[model samples]
Target: KALQFQEAKEKRQKTLAALDTMMKGKDEEAIKKLLEQKQQEEAELQERLGEASQKKQAELMSLREQKEEVMRRIHVVEAILIILCVAFSCSKRRLECNSDKNFDRASSLFTSTN
Candidate 1:
């Protein structure tokens, strides 16, 4: 009976050792899965960052083009305004010269009548 008890005790110790090894393997697998998940999340974040960068660059280019277009329009308006000012100045000078000639003719006619 003592030998049987000794054999049973040895078997229990062997079983406990096997269980410990299995638990360690399971722990390693869990750690590996967590690492893979973390890597996947990081890759997704990188992809999103790249997309956002591209979108912002496109928006910046579009805004630059719009600004250039607006500047061109402003330059065109300024040229038109300059041309109109020059035309109006010439017309005013012509009107002043004609008025002076009419006044001289009237003065001569009045002296002859007197």
Candidate 2:
């Protein structure tokens, strides 16, 4: 009976040790899984940030191009207005000279007729 008790006690110790080892292994596995999940989430967040940065750059470039185009159009309109003003000034001067010349001719004609 003493030998039997010793054998049973040894068997129980071996079973307890095996269960402890298995639980330790499961805990390590759980920790590794959590770590891997966190890493994947971080990588996905980085990717999204990169995409957003690129999109912002593209929008900025487009806006700059549009501003350049608008400035060019404004310059063209200013040039056109300047040209029109100069032409109108020249026309006005020419009309005034022609009127003066006609008045001089009529005065000479009246003097000759008298």
Candidate 3:
């Protein structure tokens, strides 16, 4: 039991010594340099993000303009189609009326002769 206790005490002392060296023996200049480098990287990333956002906004505006132009063209085509349909309907009715009058005149002539 005494041997085990001695071994445990030696291990504890060695662990404490290692912890002290790790905490106090480090270089402060190196740590500051690493922190500054990280901050510069973050700034560059933010600048790139801002630029990308602006580009996307410009693209969206262009697409919106294109959509409006297409809508205007569609409205013009719809108006032309409606006008054509009306004209065709009026001509069809005129032809039907003329044919009916001719048919009536022929029947009247046949009855009068008989």
lDDT of 2 by residue, 28-85 (tens): 9999999999999999999999999999999999999999877766655655555455
C-alpha TM-scores of all predictions: 0.71, 0.74, 0.51
* Candidate closest to the true structure, highest TM-score: 2
lDDT of 1 by residue, 68-90 (tens): 87776665565555445545655
- In candidate 1, which residue ranges exceed 4 Å CA deviation? 94-114
Tell me the RMSD of model 2 versus the true structure: 15.7
Instruction: Tally clashing residue pairs in candidate 2.
Output: 0
- Which residue pairs overlap in candidate 1's backbone? none
lDDT of 1 at 71: 75
lDDT scores for all predictions? 0.75, 0.76, 0.72
| Model 3 Cα lDDT, one tens digit per residue, 1-114 | 999999999999999999877766565657888999999999999999999999999999999999987776665555555445545655767555555554455445444434
Decoy 3 TM-score against native: 0.51
Per-residue error for 37 in candidate 1, Å, reads 0.3
* Error at 5, model 3, angstroms: 37
lDDT of 3 at 29: 58
